[model samples]
Target: MDIKKIAVIAGDVIGPEVVSEGVKVMKKAAEIDGRISFEFTYFPWGCEFYLEQGKMMDEDGVCPA
Candidate 1:
């Protein structure tokens, strides 16, 4: 079995809404594979955040705490 890390940036308005469905499908597909898994990390940095922080993502796209 193997684990995969997926970094998703559902940036701006409808981005999250659309990505959610895609993720849902991917999850189901992963389940059928049975030997692979997905680890999703959502980064809350987008246009709204950029308005406040002036950056779309971190220097490396990592979520800052």
Candidate 2:
């Protein structure tokens, strides 16, 4: 059996909270089944981040390639 890693890209304020809840649910389900593993990465990018960087994530915040 192979375990798949999931990547969650949280974009803004509410994004983090929503993603957190989703992860919680996944954990519960995995605990019940006892056969799944997950990896989560949080990217901090939003209004506050834009204010600091002077650019949005879509622009130059992250390079495409």
Candidate 3:
């Protein structure tokens, strides 16, 4: 089995929408190919988050600390 890992950070504005569409397409591809799969990890850190948290993200935001 071949699996690919993807990290997604929906920053703001069209970022989420674009990522959503990409994920949908990738999922379809994976579904069609049994040997191929994807593992998606989402990180919530962006401009909108900064407005509320006063920072774009924590020091280890990417690593989820």
Among these predictions, the greatest TM-score belongs to 1
Listed in order, each prediction's TM-score against the native is 0.79, 0.60, 0.76
The local lDDT score (0 to 100) that residue 1 gets in candidate 1 is: 78
Per-residue lDDT over 1-65 for candidate 1, one digit per residue giving the tens place of the 0 to 100 score = 79998978886666988989989998999999999899998888888888888977678775565
Estimate, for each residue in 1-65, the C-alpha lDDT of model 3 and write its tens digit.
89998888876776889989999999999999889999998888888788889998877765632
Give a tens-digit lDDT track for model 2, residues 1-65. 33656757666656877988998998788778878766675666778778998766656445554
User: What's model 2's overall lDDT?
Assistant: 0.71
lDDT score of residue 44 within candidate 2: 62
What residue pairs clash in candidate 1, if any at all? none
| Ranked candidates, highest lDDT first | 3, 1, 2
* Alpha-carbon local distance difference test for all models: 0.85, 0.71, 0.85
The regions of model 1 sitting more than 4 angstroms off are: 60-65
